[model samples]
Target: MRGPWSSIQSKLVFLIAGISMVTVLVGFSLVTERFAQSLRDSLENDSLSLAQRLVVDSAAYLSLGMAGQARDNLLDKVVLNSPHSLALFDEQGGLFAEIERGGGQIVVDDYRPESAVIWESDWLHIYQPVEDSLDQRIGTLYLKISLSQLSHRMRAFVGVLLVLLLVMLALAYFLARLMQRYISGPILTLADISRQVRDHQNYSLRAPVKSSDEIGVLSQTFNDMLETIEQQQAFRDKVEQSLRIKEERLERAVAELQYMANYDSLTGLPNRALCMDRIELAIRHASRTRTYAGIIYLDLDHFKDVNDSLGHAVGDELLKATAERLSDVLREEDTLARIGGDEFVIITTDFSSSDQIIPLVSKVVERFEQNFTVGRYSVQSTVSLGVCVYPDDGDSVDALMKAADAAMYKAKDVGRNTYAFFEAEMNRMAVWRQQLGSELQHAIDRDELYLVFQPKVALESGQISGAEVLLRWEHPEFGSVSPADFIPVAEHTGLIYRIGLWVLEQACEAVSRWRDVGLEGVTVAVNLSAAQFRQADLVEHIAAILARHNVPPQTLELEITESMLVRDVDQAIRMLKRIKLLGLRVAIDDFGTGFSSLSYLRKFPLDALKIDRSFIMDLGKNRDDTAIALAIISMASSLRLKVVAEGVETPAQWSFLAGHLCDEVQGFLISPGLRESEFISFYKSFSLDEVIASRNV
Candidate 1:
């Protein structure tokens, strides 16, 4: 139904037919022209041959003066051989003889050699001079060859050309029609499909692909585009329907995300992030109004015990109840937030005075006096509260939080269920503690730490038995940092593990050195911190250190505190047994200090019991201190454990401990902790009996 312009078939057929006709006409003309030129060349060659022969024959006749013979030869042999005319003329420009196919004579009035020959439109004329053997110009002969043979051949060529032209035209037309079907067919189909899709918005229609040509590729691409459009249209329809529901869900999702970000998931209270933001806002408000705001940081005491005894399910329920109870006690303007597990912060703004905030902190602490019922369990818990007021304790959120945290620890240090306000000195101490912790990590690498030995002597003879290894640090900035100062810092920061291992390695090496110098049976005792004792690799580490130094375990004694032994009695017993199995002596340092049960004392694998310095410092002056020291000595003797009294600075103290049957004594009364050289000198210079005899004298 498509028109010729629209139909590729019709248009290709017309284009092919017009091109074929023009090609045929041009080919016919070229063939006829070439054939006519060949026939003309043949006629010219034949006329030249006849003219040359006639000239030669006519020369003989002219030399002999026989014109009749020249005429017969030229006419019969030359002109008769060609469909042309022949003429002969003398040197004097007079016509001698002339012959033509029609037997007509050519009239020459004053023929010259230059005008001897002339070509006509239909004839090729040639002129030749007849010469004798003497090379003299005698006479001229001329011929006019006919071009009619060339015309006949051209006519015959045209007849054959027309026939071939018609045949070629038929083939070209058929070829064009076939090409249109194969090449343009797919393109037209694609166009039609596109039109249908554009008019009806139907993306499901696909164009037919019949060949692998460019048009076929175009059809395939159009089909792929339609498929993509169909998928996208279906997706678009689904998206439109879900968009409304997604909008509704989006609002609720935003609210939920915000709540989860700001509030604790378990207690539904503001989290640490929200609390800090509120604290900043509160500080700004207080700064603007020239008022005070208090930040009370509270942590529940013994909460871990509840979780450990019962399941975490009970712990969760308990935390929820605690949150509710704390919320009930807060004023409408006050805020309570859970920063972490069992730790809460309360911000009280709009307070006129510091005293007004005390009742709030007190109420929060008093609420824990009653037991909490969670599930089927009733748990008793207490809280330690640290309060820091704005413009007094700190001006910034981080500073205030740290100050309050320090104060809370101070409250726990004094007793649980108590509240303490942050003071300026507390901040200074916290900063100092942090600095000491930082410096302690590099103490060993800096070579600023060293060990001094304090000799333990037999009380009966006053002879040196062994030495205790004491850690000391000389800071480049602080001059001399006390063990009292940096030891706790190291312990708090978990640096004690590394420091303790270093001490053990050094002590073992020192003992090995002493033994190499003939100091037999010289044992070195190294104190182990609570943190060091809890390491899973403690036994292996100590064993490696001892083996590395080639020191026997008996010469390397490990001294642990009473508190370490009682922390977990069963685990402590296992560790002690392992230490004993290695042939290393174990001692309980600072006895009669930790609030441990006396019944478990016998279960510890110990070689000695060192009386705490606190008990020994007050000996002979305080009956309670005297009785405790005596009780330790008696218990150690009964248990067959060596008794050592520490910190015996005065004669009376040493004499009292010796008289009470204390087996070993270590303190300043003998000599302060000595450097390695000093200890070696002291060891060679004095014996137990000699020192005792000198003291008595």
Candidate 2:
């Protein structure tokens, strides 16, 4: 029973029953809304003076015309004395008279002529017109009225204002129980003597001072705070046992500085920032138990050849005996970690199936193929691993540790004592090559990349000389995404050196717009990527995009691939002799598909080779692709080099590459790429008049 604000005598009976029911419901709702607006303005002036005495008693029944016999003697005296529904219209608004009381339908153009009263929701209406003896109106008188007897006089004046708001809230709850004995009986006797001095920690009970008011000075300051808490209870139990032994030695020095800040003092494990915070709490516990959460990554394969042939204290005791033999084969809710030098990772969580992550990564690659003595150095290791899992291969903890370090470099490329699984086609090409390297690093500032060109035809002078500059994209939600699907996702995300300097300033402004449309010496090309030819600002951004598009440098060619000139054949012969001392023209592109060695391709600086469309896609039925496109046009006519075959398509592979003097040729036989105003309107009026009219037929 203690709840109207729980007790000081039910908070003085709910503060005198909420100020006597909000002052008797706001003085009975402002005296019943001003006595229901003075009984609706005295029932609209007594139904507009009983519709102006039924329009002056039907103006003597409309001057003896017998107004329907005075509306059947005033419709039974308006249904026994005006409770309302009376009607009589005339001046052409028809219903000359009516009373049949059931309610609502009283239209005679709802009688207006300066309406006297009209209310509605359950009738009020009252109009009156008639006149005659020198006034001259004729007929009209309405009276509706059924607001059910003023809604039974405002429901008996809201039942006498809800019985005077419950007799002023039962006389303000008996004057708040007679003012709770001068306010809740001395604050409930100082709240039952401070709840028996707080449930009997009895500080020698007191609170009896009866009436010096302010509850006798709050019972004399609660008996002087129980005489200073029984005179400081044995010095607060010896300073609360020395603050519980200094909060258990400050919680054991903050759990040893949170385990030396998330572990790994020489491989005590849990480290790469506490294994990426336990691989983001096992990827939110494998997304709430739909279960599966692997991660492994390991990597100690040739632990940097035993940390460079055993030294740093036997490579820190071989990464602490390989993190205690991979935490003795994991699952006490797995985690393992190290994450430094010889990497480590592990993680796991509620597996059950994904073929139980290849027998738990073949028991940690058979515990790193056995040998591990460390102090007296007994090494031999082998661990690659990689795995990945949860939500296929990555639902983030840095995309499942970068899809378990790209499946541990595809388990050291399928060799090093393995364990791979991060596949769903390499996690959908590493999440669509990280969403096309974050949309090709804003695809050349959202133009979603472009450039199409593709021409290179010469074929022993059947014309349209050069084109290539490919790089396409489109993508507004994955549409035409293919430079063979985003140029290896922009060369594994270096965003191919800003998409190879925006395709070398858009292929040198399309070879200075094919030399301002005369289409002179056309060469366009472009390609690039061994991370954009190891960019030491690729020969000063291709000689400042061929002098910012004024073009020259032999109308710009570049291309690159023989696996980017054998990685570093002396920095590809000093960046191909500074791009052939910027007179520019280097090709090699997909030529004989890469492992170039005419002794570093005749020591670098030479030019054209092209060839590779898998040797022009089975050139005239493959006699080993016509002896590798006739030994790449007889080794680019004996190294003075200039071949260019690439996907020639037909006319017998362009008449067997122009009978083998193949100096130039590109795909879809000579056109297929186009858009720079359709390769300058097909090299201005059909490239040498359509290859000299298709080679004179």
Best by lDDT: 1
lDDT of 1 by residue, 1-697 (tens): 8665877668877887778778777877776777776776677666677778777778988878788888888756853433666777887868787776842346684254752344466667778878888978888887766656556667777777878888888887888788767766776777788889999999989888777777778888888999999999889978976897798799889999999899999999999999999999999999999999999999888665455445478878888898999999998888899998889999989878877899888888888999887776667788999989998888999989999988887787677899999987788777887789888999999998999999998888667899999999999998889998898678656688888888888888888889888888888888987666766678999889889999989988888888677645776888888888989999989888887666888788889989999999989999999998888888888889999888877777877987889998898777789988899999989765555555565
lDDT of every predicted structure (CA atoms): 0.82, 0.77
TM-score of each: 0.59, 0.25
Candidate 2 lDDT tens digits, 76-152: 45543335567777766677767756665676567665556768776777777888988988777777767777778
Compute the lDDT for candidate 1: 0.82
* CA deviation > 4 Å runs, candidate 1: 1-276, 297-346, 363-385, 398-417, 427-431, 618-623, 637-640, 650-661, 689-697
Clashing pairs in 2: 423-426
Best by TM-score: 1
TM-score of 2: 0.25
